[model samples]
Target chain A: MEASGEVRRFAHQQWPYEPNYKRVNGWQMHYVDEGVGNPVVLLHGNPAWGFLYRKFVKPLSAAGRRVIVPDMVGFGLSEKPVREQAHTLDGHIANLTGLLRQLDLRNATMVCHDWGGPTGLGFALSNSDRVRALVIMSTWAWPLPPAEFHKRIFPWRMMHAPLVGPYLLGHHNALAGRGMYLSVVDRKKFRAEAQSVYEGILPDPGSRLLTWTWPRWIPLDESARGLARFEWLERELRKSKFPTLLVWGREDEVFDHATFATRFKELLPHAEGPELVTGRHFLQEDSGEEIAGKINRFLDRIDGKQS
Target chain B: MTEIHVIENYTPEGKRRAFVLAEDRVGHYPEFREFFVRQFSLGANRLERPGYVRASSGMIYALVFIGRSGEPFPDGIEIYALPDALEPLNDSDVDADLWALLRWMIAGVGGEWRVEQLDATGRLYQLSVAANA
Candidate 1:
């Protein structure tokens, strides 16, 4: 057999909240909606899914903030057709924006993490006012990776390969559950059910192709047309006057918070800022309640949704 | 006479079930996903709205209830224990209210007053109370 198909993992931990999985763009998108008032949209990035917000979702919603989280195509509960079409960063953003449009969510507070950078901004760039505030996490929005760090995250030597390439993704666990679990060291904090929910997302190896190939679309070169629109998006992010909240995990690996911290401050100078000391690229999972508190105070302080 | 609200893990047929009270009409919350993910020490709730809990160990079991209505749920409050701090519920541990516990959780949140953890088992715990932190 070319690959194994035994990925029946369960989020053994029960969510204090229930998850509502809906169909859209030919896939099932699992999201949680709580309370009413203003809507806060959280977009996750590569190898990661909406589950990243598992920690923050509850507290935010409990505080009367409507939280919307979607696992982009090929990730989480979204159907990953192993035999079908390819997953593109641009395509993922479009599908997510479509989800928002279909739901008719207005004045949303957009929060992005990792690959979420472009996904969150792509929509905000076009509908600036609808975006109440921008929360940029450990990721980037510019075209292509800086020549210095491209190989660090998206080494073509592996992604462009024909066969073993996909295996590398699953083998790393970062490409799958092991990788995600390996990143978090605290064992007691996570219940069997919580780990089950996160790992349950990936069903097989073929479906794991999205994780293998998504990094390839980082707009590494001119041949990638996506780079153009991304360049424009980055410029818009830098100039947009919307109130922004930038939270960086000081301990992030791929996205050294130190580097992006300065970048965001320069781009959105007046934005409210908070730093997570022991945080990782997945800050919400590492410190969800704390971040939700920061968001709560931020919203109340600046009225994040007031137009 | 006070209301005797009961939560049973097993029905008469021995099938396990979740008991959500009348005020619990909201059923399951869709937005509590992350708090479960992050495992924040203490989850925040409405000014006076508290949640419910049931803890059991071996032969000893304790039904815990806490509310944030204008009055405490049934007239009791609760508290936060250290992580994985599971223990048998003793008759001595059962009290009219959960003041010490709820206060501990609020103190963790930088607040001196918030939440009431009533270690109560009775009908009074069912009646809604006046507003509280």
Candidate 2:
């Protein structure tokens, strides 16, 4: 699905970055490349594009690292594939891999959040030599026992219902509509313009095929398809020695720091602190500056070690 | 006398706040609400948000509401204006088409109903409704 003229104009005005695209994995993947040094690849999660890290690009790039933020296929300014079957965990991993290879990004620092953790880390684990450091936040790479949050499935369960899922997510845009609002700790920080862009990008049901399929992609049980892939990622993450930072949204209602973050630390025991920041699901909107500062400091420490 | 109360309602596909026009009669609101709901082809196509319903004469109407927020709002019909509902041909004609539609709705729910605009403070005023309208 091509972005509407109105949505394109609004995104350009708010982000003000040169829109770059590369045809990777049979789709036009959009990205923002800034600075000229060791590459720092930022990957955004479901229902959002590269715009989620708008605040991080300038600051991180200015600190002397090339910042590469991709919208991923089926999101942001990227061409959205209408088929539900086109969106899958492996498909997304391959999508990211294709983009990285096209850009030939190596020894790159990976910053991932939400669905990004799996997509970005999935790539990092496969090509360990290409990934220098890792910053993981508010996402899971492995399946977990159902928590209290997953049990309360009033609207969430309804969203995945056979007929209802398409109507709510694909049509009503339930996730894109109120998901961000409900996820954010500070409503004021979730600007109206940003909200408009998120909601506006996929205006129709066909455009929202990816958004609708994502929630169902959550591997809940034994029959889940991504179970083996996630298990592989978890095993690889535990053994990997790349300097890793676990930055978590302390107040996140979805992926609570207490549950997911703790699990992440246990896996990557050698990884740096699970530095709890004040924010929610989409923490970048709430604490982008704070997170960026922590990341810059982490990078500085790594650079100092290399020097 | 038919008095219309405006309330703010939530919609994902449409605008955040809709111009909810409710009638004064208690028992008569369901009928009033149903009359307008029949106009738009909503549901599955749009959860709670109503899109423009084209008329036999090729005229388009944005009477897009049928749900309630549990708020103590006297229910009627919701008419979305500007940006989404009716794309006004020009800036100067923004209110013209809307007022004309409101007149049509008022005429449908017939009576010597005097229209008054409800403000944010719950204070009412004769802001848009003309004495002749």
Instruction: Note the Cα lDDT for every prediction shown.
Output: 0.54, 0.67
Q: Candidate 2 DockQ category?
A: incorrect
CA lDDT, candidate 1, residue A52: 73
Q: Write the per-residue lDDT of candidate 2 for residues A1-307, one digit (tens) a residue.
A: 2344332333366588887777788887888899988999988887988878888988898999899999878877888886565788999999999999999998899999877888999999998878899999888888753245643334453344333344445545657756776778777657565777788878876777677567667766676667788888889888889898988887887788898888888998888989988788898878888999899999999999999
DockQ of every predicted complex: 0.01, 0.02
Candidate 1 chain A, poorest ten consecutive residues by summed lDDT: A1-10
Name the fnat for model 1: 0.00
Query: What are the per-residue Cα lDDT tens digits for candidate 1 across B37-88?
Result: 1222223432232233323211211222333455322322122221123333
Q: How well is candidate 2 docked (DockQ)?
A: 0.02
Question: Compared with the true structure, what per-residue lDDT tens digits does model 1 show for residues A175-241?
Answer: 4454455445353454343455555566555566576566556666676647887788878887888
Q: Pick the candidate with the highest lDDT.
A: 2
The residue ranges of model 2 lying beyond 4 angstroms of the native Cα positions read A1-11, A145-147, B1-133
Error of 2 at A27 (Å): 1.1
